[model samples]
Target chain A: GAGVSQSPSNKVTEKGKDVELRCDPISGHTALYWYRQSLGQGLEFLIYFQGNSAPDKSGLPSDRFSAERTGGSVSTLTIQRTQQEDSAVYLCASSRPGSNEKLFFGSGTQLSVL
Target chain B: SQQGEEDPQALSIQEGENATMNCSYKTSINNLQWYRQNSGRGLVHLILIRSNEREKHSGRLRVTLDTSKKSSSLLITASRAADTASYFCATDVRRDKIIFGKGTRLHILP
Candidate 1:
């Protein structure tokens, strides 16, 4: 793809339901990241992936949140037993190695747990 | 906790005026990057300043880094209506990951 791509631009799920968000990073990019943003708030880092390995998962809020990247191309973020507090926009970004810190972002998935 | 923190949660300025946003980080960083988000969507990378470098420029955008103070600033010269967006600063504290701050909402008055 020309840029990072995320699926289901918007999602509305009930509390206790499970939700899966997806991210497709640009071709040949070696690094990927996941972030969450609540209404009018700053971004909260959730995870980072180099190739297919996630070296930093310290940012995941709880055990209910987990993510995995496969084939070094697409990634999935799964939230189990979602709560109202899970409502937020999940953003994904990818960067090429040696690009310093330049990141290309996807539009993001807006998840609303009611 | 976020490694970087942006100041001035919100700012409104007239078009053609210069707008500046500042970011402060808690630890040493390899580099600092500035991004712009429109309508709360995905962000676009604007500029980056390496820790060893003090300043950099990209067209109308100017970025400065102060490792001694652990701070950075983004300046948009002759801002335009289209320049209205939220600006974010991200720090590459760890070589493998980057953390972002809340961001500053910049509104350009027509």
Candidate 2:
């Protein structure tokens, strides 16, 4: 793809249900990131992947949240037990190696846990 | 935790006036970049300043970085209605990942 692509654009789920958001990064980009933004709030770092390196999960809010990058092209973020507080817009971004400063972002998936 | 803190949570100014937002970070960084978000969607990268650079300009945007103070400022010249959006500053804290601030919401009064 010419730019980062995210799936579903919007997802509405009941509390305690699980949800999965997907992201397709720009081709050949070696770095991908996931961020969460609550209503009228700053973005919260969730996870990061650089090449084949072990993902940096220091930012994941809880064990319920997990992500995987398959074949270094697509990524998925799964929230095991959704809570109302989990409602937020999940963003995905990618950048070329050594160009982490310049990121290309996807439109994001707006998750609403009711 | 957020690596940067943007000043003035929100600002309202006339369309032709210039708007300036400041960001302060706590640790050494590889670089600092600014982005714009509209309607709470994805953000668009505006400019980036490496730790070694002090100032950079792009079109009507000017960015300044002060490593000693661990701060950066973004100035939008001749702001337009289209510039009414949220501005964020992101820092590469460890050269591995980027973290963004709470952002400054800019509203241009027509």
Number of clashing residue pairs in every model? 1, 0
lDDT of 2 by residue, B44-64 (tens): 999999999999999999999
Off by over 4 Å in 1: A98-100
lDDT tens per residue, model 1, B1-110: 88888988899999999999999999988889999999888999998888899999999999999999999999999999999999999998788688899999999999
Residue-level lDDT of model 2, residues A73-96, one tens digit each, is 899999998999999999999999
TM-score of chain A of each: 0.97, 0.96
**Candidate 1 residue lDDT tens string, A29-107:** 9899999999999889999999999988999999999999999889999999999999999999999975637899999
Q: What is the TM-score of chain B alone in each candidate?
A: 0.97, 0.98
What TM-score does structure 2 among the candidates reach?
0.98
lDDT of 1 at B22: 98
Query: Which residue pairs clash within candidate 2?
Result: none
